[model samples]
Target: MTRTLGIMTEGNDVEALYRRLAWRRQIVLLTGLAALAFSLVLDVATGPAMLPVPAVARSILGLAQDRTVDAIVWSIRLPIAFLALAVGAALGLSGGIMQTILNNPLASSYTLGVSAGAGFGAALVIVLGVAIPLPEAWAIPAMAFLFSGIACAGVYGIGSLRGSSPEMLVLGGIALLFLFQALLALLQFVASPEALQQIVFWLFGSLQKATWPKLWIISAVLAVSLPLLLLDAWRLTALKLGDERARGLGVDVARLRIRSFAIISALTGVAVAFVGTIGFVGLVAPHIARMLVGEDQRGLLPASALFGALLLSLSSIASKTLLPGAVVPIGIVTSLIGVPFFVWLVIRSRRAFW
Candidate 1:
């Protein structure tokens, strides 16, 4: 009887500990979301015109009547600001999944060749023109989206030949990365100077081209993909414990990995399709999210998305402010910001995040 009471007491204590941890994780997620919202407002307010934050806030809320301010807010800043959020969320979510499924801290579309594939596809359209009857504006993004999927499929296909192990998939990704990069280089070598300039600018990544249509497309993809990922949150969290353990927990490891890759491709392909290739947000944001919320895919995934959006929104502001007048390419700003931070993250951690 005494032993029974002791066991019950211990169980209660464990339950309380879990409850506290869950509450703390919730707070972390809420804080990240709040930070992301503030950053979005700041991103919208920042630019050459530099609308007052209050004015931008009013404009956003439909309370402002000043035509000039409304036009600037609605027509230019809002789309860019919102697109930054969507793209960043997509990248971060993809990165988190990649890292989880592959058990690699550095796993992301950029590292796994998906971004390079999209770049190659865009370059193909730029250099060779769309073989299909696409509107001139649609050609590049369509091809980019297509090839990103192709890269995902290619990696999976190659990995399948080697039993689709995580190591095989990563090796396949490395090969795909080199293949697409070489193809891109070949296109650049033969590209006319004007075409080459356009390609380079696209590669540099910019939010200047953000439009309502583009924002909607990215938002739509995010809307679709996020729910699918969240549905498998438990399965994904299990995946973090390695394939043998996940399978021991009744997960079909191969199927889950394949499904994850499909979603990752959609998230990544669409993101880079529009924005070119913005690196590090995917790579760093998930790590940040992991630090805040640990590895529960439910909290971690949303946190990763929020932090990703926050990072990109902050980067957008810096891109405008860093150069005084000329807005730098956001990709360059992200790289500059990401590199040192990434180095710090690598050094500061007491042990492996993966």
Candidate 2:
């Protein structure tokens, strides 16, 4: 009777421990959301006109209507600021999903060739001057999204030949990365000087070209993708235990990975398609999220999206303020800031947080 009581006591302790962890995760997510909100207002306020944060906030919320403030906020800066959040969230979520499904801490859309494929497609349009029925603005992103899908198909096709094992899929991605890079280089070699300059600028990544339509497209993609991925959250968490274990858990491990990969491709494609090739958000945000929230997809994925949006919003603010009048490309700022911070995170974490 005493031994039976001890087992009951142990079970209660385990349940309490889980409740504590869950509470802590909730706090972490709330903190990230708070930070993201602050950063978005800051980003809108930091541009050359230098509206006060309260002014920006008031304008954004329709609390006040100064024509000058409204024009600058609604006409100029809001699209850029909001798009940064959307793209960052998309990349962050994509990175989190990719890392989880591939069982590789290092995996991301940028590393795995989806970004490369999109960049190549954009560059091809710029160089060849492709004249589709859509306006030039729409044409490039259309092609970029298209090629991003092709990259997903390529990864899936190649991986399936080897039974869709994670190792085989990763190898296929690396090979495609190289292939796309080489194609991009060749396009650069033959491109006209003007077209080459355009290519170079596009590759640098900027939010300067942001517009309401582009912002809506990405926001819509995020809206659709997030719920769908969240629905599979339990299966994704199960897959982290290892393929055999996940299979034993009645998760269709292969199907789960493939579905996740396709979603990552679409997210990455839409992100880079509009803004060009912003890199480190996809690679860094997920690791930071995982460290804070652990590997449960419900927490990890949304935390990753929040952190990613925060990082890029911060980057966008720096891009404007860094050079005082000339806006710096956001991609440069992200790499410069993200690399050291990422390395520090990697070094400081003593255990394998993955």
CA RMSD per model (angstroms):
1.1, 1.2
Highest lDDT scorer: 1
Clash pairs detected, candidate 1: none
What does candidate 1 score on TM? Answer: 0.98
Alpha carbon lDDT of each predicted model: 0.91, 0.90
lDDT of 1 by residue, 46-120 (tens): 989888898888899999979899999999899999999999999999998998888888889998899999999
Which runs in model 2 stand beyond 4 Å of their true positions? 351-353
Candidate 1, superposed: residue stretches over 4 Å from native:
none
Residues 1-354, candidate 2: write the lDDT tens digits. 999999999999999988988998999999998899999999999887799899899999998668889899999899999999999999999999988888887788888888899999999899997777888888999989999989888987888899988898888889899999999999999999999999999989999999999999999999999999999999999988888999999999878887898898889989999999988898899988888888889998999999999999999999999898889999999999988988888899953345
Q: What residue pairs clash in candidate 2, if any at all?
A: none
Residue 190 displacement in candidate 1 (angstroms): 0.3
Every model's TM-score:
0.98, 0.97
lDDT score for residue 286 of model 2? 91
Model 2, residue 71: displacement in angstroms? 1.1
